[model samples]
Target: MIQRAETEHSKELGCAKHLLLAIGSANVIGVSLPASLSSHAGPGAGQGRSVFFSDGVSRIRLTLDENSPVLIENSGETAVLTFDGPGGLISVEGFVEKTGCHCPKQAYITINEGCIFSCRYCNVPNLDKHIKTPDEIASLISDAVRRENVECISLTSGVVGTMQEEDERLFAILERVRPFGLPIGVSVYPTPGLSQRLFELGVSEVKFNLETATGKLFAEMCPSLDRDVLCNALKEAVGIFGKNRVYTNIILGLGESKAEMKQCITHCLENGVIPIIRPLTPSAQLSHFSRPLAEDILSISEFLQSELLRFGLDPSASKTMCAKCMGCDLTPMTDLHLGEVTP
Candidate 1:
C-alpha cells in the first residue's frame, strides 16, 4: 500500500510538471506571434491556433501565440482565468462581458521611503526621492485612460509609514482617482482597516501578495511584517469584497514545494480569495537567482484551476464588468468575453 501511494503521488507530480511546461511554452510562443496574426484570430483561437487539454477534473483551452494568452471557461459560464505571468493565476467567478476600462500609463510615483519589509527576492531600490503630488498622479492616469489604450491599472508602492499611515495614503490615492470611474487594482500591506478603506473607495480589486508559500520562507523574505497580519488582512478583504474581487499574489520560483503552494492556494480559496500565481521575474541586480522553470508555472496554474472547480468557482461567470465604455480597448482578441470595446 505504501509503494502504491508513493507511485500515485509521483504520477501526480509528473502531471503537474507537464502542465507547467505547456503554460510556459505557451507564453513564449504567444509573445512571438505576429501582431497581424493575433488581430485576425477569432475569440477562441490564439494567433489562429487553439490548444486544448483536459486532465480529467478540468478542461483548459488557451491561445499561446502571444504573451501566453489563456481563456479558461468551464461549464459554459462558470469561472474566468486570468494570469499575471509573474504572479499566479486568478479565477474569477460570475464572469461578465463588461468593456475594459482605460488606465494610465505605467509610471512609478515616489509615494514614500524604502520598504520596511526586507524581502530577500525583491530587487526594488529604496530611493529617497521626491514623491509625486496627487495631481501629478491623476494627470498620468487620465492620459493613460483617455489617450493610451489602457484597460486596467495596478498601483503599488513600497511600504511607507507605519501601518496606520500607509492605510491613510492608500485611501487618499484611491479617493483621488475614484472620480474617473476606472477599475483600479492596488497592492498594499495586509492591514484589515486598510482593506476596508480600499473597498469603500470603490476600488475594483485588492492584491495582498503572499510572495512565497512556506511560513518559514515568508518570515525569512519579509522579516519585518507579521505573517499573521497579512493573513488577517487577506481574510478581511475577502469578507468585504466577494472572493472574485480579492486576489493574492504568489511567486512560484522562490524555493517552495508544490504541496506548499497548493496548501497556500487552498487557504486563499477557503477564505474566498483568488490566488494570482506568476513566475519569478528577478531584477537585473538579482539575476544570479534562477527563475522557476516554465513548467512550474503551468503546474501551479493547473492546480489552482482544478481546485477552483472543486470549490464551485467558475471563471466564465466573472466576465469583465465594464463592457459599455469603449474609450480604450484592452481585451485580448482571444478573450471570449470581449465586450463592445474592440481591441
Candidate 2:
C-alpha cells in the first residue's frame, strides 16, 4: 500500500520548489507586477529581438517586447526573464521561473485573452486582449517550429463569448496549422460537445481546466461557473475523448484538503480524464492567498503516484503539453513517482 506521508528529501524538494514559485528567488533578481503593454503595441515583434533564458540544460526564446502579466528576474541559477523595454521590475509575488529545457519541442500560443466571465484568481483581464487572423496564427506556428527542437503546438485562450464561440475560433486556427502535420494540444473551458468537436478536428490532446476541485471552492473562486455544468462537461469529454486523451487542471493551495484533492484524482481516473495538477502561484490579482505548504504538495504528489500509475497514466508518457513539457512546475506527479527525476 502507498503511504500518504512525504519523505524527508521529498519534503525538502517540495518546500524548495514551492518557495521558488511562491516567492521568486529574490537573491537572483528582483521583479514586480508589470503594467499594461497597450502602451508598447507599436509594431509587430521583429526577428532576432527575442531574449533567451536557460537552466543550463534547456533553453527558451521569449519575445518580451511588450508588458506581461508576469514580472521576471534571473535567479542566476535556473531560468531568467528579460523584457525588451524599460521598467522590467515592479513588485509581484509567487513568481517562479519556468524550468528550462534544451531544444524545446513544444510551441505555445494564445488565441485571445478576452473573457466573458471573470474568475477572481484570473489575471488575464489585467492585459489588453486581441484576436489573431488565421494567417497570422499560421505564421506564428510557422516561425515557432523553424527550430528542429519544436515538434508540437499548444494553444490556450480565454472565453470570447461562450464555449461554442471559442471553439469556432480555435477551429479556424487549427485548420491553418493542420497542414504542418504537427500535433496540437489545447486547454480551454469545458462546453457541451467541445471535446467531440476537438476530436473531430483531429486534435492530439484536449485539456479542460476545472481550476479548483471542491464544489464549494469552485463556486467561491469561480462565481460565474455552474458546478453541475462543469462536472457534466468533464464526464462528457471523457466519453468522447477517451482515457488519457482528456485532461483537467487542479490548482493546489486554494484551501483544498488532501482528501478533497484525492477525490478529484480518483474521479478523473474513473472518468478517463487525467488530472493536470499544479500548485498555486500568487499573482498581483490573487496575492491575498498564501503559497501551499511544501510538505503538503509533496505528500499529495507522493500520494497521487500510485493512483495515477494504477490508472495507467505516466507523466513522462503524456503526449500533450504540461505533463510532458514539465517546464513550469518542479514536482508534477506526472514527471515521476516520488520526486525521482527521469532522464
TM-score of 2: 0.72
TM-score, every prediction: 0.61, 0.72
What lDDT does each candidate get? Answer: 0.50, 0.58
- At residue 145, candidate 2 shows an lDDT of 67
Q: Write the per-residue lDDT of candidate 1 for residues 125-183, one digit (tens) a residue.
A: 33342344567678766755665545555566666467787777767777787787656
Candidate 2 lDDT over residue span 1-343, tens digit each: 1122232122222233433333322222344322212211101111112333334332222334333323346443333332121222222222333311111456666677556677776666554667777788788677656734567777777766666677788889888888888777888776777778787877888777787879888988888878677678878876776656777778887888889999987887777777866777564346677767656665666666767667776555567566655444543453232533232
